[model samples]
Target: MRPVLIALPVLALAFLAGGLALTRPVTVPDTALAGLTGDAIAGEAVFWAAGCASCHAAEGATGAARLVLAGGQRFASEFGTFIAPNISMHPEQGIGAWSFADFVTAVQEGTSPEGRHYYPAFPYGAYRLAARQDLADLWAFWQTLPSADTPSAPHEIGFPFSIRRAVGAWNLLNLHDDFVVTGELTEAETRGRYLAEALAHCAECHTPRDALGGLDRRAWMAGAPNPSGSGTIPALTPDRLTWSEAEIAAYLNDGFTPDFDSAGGHMVSVIRNIAMLGDEDRLAIAAYLKALPPAGD
Candidate 1:
């Protein structure tokens, strides 16, 4: 009995130690951004394409007001409601104080400057594929943005879901930088793939997720159920989306479908951001969508 009790305590200690190691934050090296110069002009395009304003801007903000990233948006998921944090240029209330390495860690590795894991709601898994130069440029552009002193709201989560450390384990399982669309060819399609998969994170919502909340890549862009439980998110695969490339490009540019239907729901917000992009970019997105294999194939 004495031997059994000793072994039980030893096992418990081992388990605790293992958990600590697993949850340790994964960060980029301080030298990761070394020698890389940031260009704010290029980053402006990346910012709009990534739709940073969609989740971080003040609710109901319009026009140039969208540039103010005072994040207080609420995102509901199966786990809980996650609030977008203030990412404005405010030194205290936002990421203005973060170094380029810190931004890279947060955006690419989903680890905060304080070595904490961020929830998947921020979509770093997709953002991880972003080019290092783009990240540097983004950081440069971030610095140029107007400062907002809006404090971040805490996420409304419960129990195990609220455990930020557990997110490290989740990252181990689901976080990857691989391109979803393989066997790509055209230069335009390649560019489009990067835009859709990395920057815009179209798959984050357009694709279905597994029980653990990781993307089900097999169904890639086949659409998914709305997390709000209101209705289904439409599939973007060739199986369902048969729109012509020209029509798709037009829709992205002006929010008008082939049938003259305007973009609605959350897409309206998405279109607002995409509309700011160059015409070539909209066309690239269309070409990329046209290149995808039908769902289930």
Candidate 2:
């Protein structure tokens, strides 16, 4: 009994130590931002491509109001409800005081200035693929947006899921810094691949997950049971969609399918964001989708 009691305590300490090591925050190198100047005008395009307003803005806001970014939106998941944080330019209520390094760390490593792990709900896993230059531009453009005085609401997650340290283990399995869809490519296909896999994060919605909540890369964009627990997200692969490149581009630009059916559900906001990009960007995205191998092939 005495030996058993002694061993139990040792085991507990080892477990705790392991958890701490696994969840350690990753920091960006100071040199990452060196010699990089941000372009606010160009950053506006990155902002739209990243679809920041869709999640960070106040719920139900439209038009110019989407730019407010007060961040009261609630996302319900099996883990719990996550409230989007205020990312506006307010010093106290938002990220006004954050430096370029802080922003880059948050986007790429999912670590905050205080070294806390942001919930994966923010989709930093995909943002991890973003180029440093694009992030610099995004930071500059974000600075020009209106500041919101609204404070962020706390996430309503419980128990194990609420423990941010556990995210470190999750990251180990799923958080990759490399870009998806690598290979030799034309300029349009390359641009589209980056837009889809990095900035737009289309996979976040269109792909399914395993029981551990990590994306099932084997089934990439083959559609998923929507996280909202409603209708299915359609597969975008050539086998399922069969839309011509022009039709895909037109749908992205105008939200009308070849059959005149409009995009609905969460995709409506996605279309709106894509609409803010140039025609070439829309065409590029379409071209990339059309080039994808058929699902399961």
Candidate 3:
């Protein structure tokens, strides 16, 4: 019994050490920000492509009001309610004081300037796949937006979910910076893949997650229950969509189906964001969706 007790404590210590290692933050290389030059005009397009306003902007805001990224939007999940932080240009209430490296770390590595791990709710896993040039341009454009003095609300998460270090372990299993599909894709397909997988982060919503919240890549783009636990998010696989390429593009651009059905729910904002893209981009996205292998419900 004495020997067994000693061995048990040793095993417990070892387990604790392993968990700490798994949660360790990755180092951000200084070269990530080197030689980065950004254009505010170009950044505006990147901003829309990344769909920043969808989460950061005020709910139901329209026209010029949509540009205010004060971030009071609440996202409820099985974990708990997460309040979006203020990302506006305000020096105190927002990220105005952050440096280029800080932004890069937050977006790509899911680490804050103070070296805290961000919850996966921030979607850095997808943003990690974004091109460095695009991130630079997006940051530049974000700087041009007007600042708001709104303060951010704290997230209402509890217990295990509230422990940010636990998220590092989750990242170990789920986080990666690679494109979902591999092969010699055409130019349009490649562009669409980047837009869909990286910038737009479509899988963050469309693809169902395992119990641990990791995306089920085997069932890629197969619709899942809304993360909000409200309604079913429709599948976008070719088997389910069945729309012609033109119809797909039209739906993305105008939010209207060939049957004259209008988009609703979360898709309304998604359509609005994609509509900001050029016609070619819309067509490319449609082409990519049509080319994908179908997954069943």
Instruction: In angstroms, give how far residue 194 of model 2 lies from its true place.
Output: 0.4
Error of 3 at 73 (Å): 0.9
- Give lDDT: candidate 1, residue 213: 77
How many pairs of residues collide in each model? 0, 0, 0
Instruction: Give the distance in Å from residue 85's predicted Cα in candidate 3 to where it truly belongs.
Output: 0.9
Candidate 2 weakest ten by summed lDDT: 1-10
Q: Would you give me the overall lDDT of model 3?
A: 0.82
24-104, model 1: which lDDT tens digit per residue? 778999886789999999999899888889889987677988989999988888777989999998999998998899999
Every model's TM-score:
0.92, 0.92, 0.92
- The per-model lDDT (C-alpha) reads 0.84, 0.84, 0.82
Kindly report the root-mean-square deviation of model 3 from the true structure over all alpha carbons: 5.4
Which digits, one per residue and each the tens of the lDDT, describe model 2 over residues 10-90? 345435755668658788877867999999999999999999998998766678887888898888776789999999999
lDDT of 3 by residue, 51-136 (tens): 88888889876667778999999998776789988889998999888887888898888998889888778888988998888988
Residue 292 error, candidate 3, Å? 2.0
What stretches of model 1 exceed 4 Å from their correct place?
Answer: 1-20
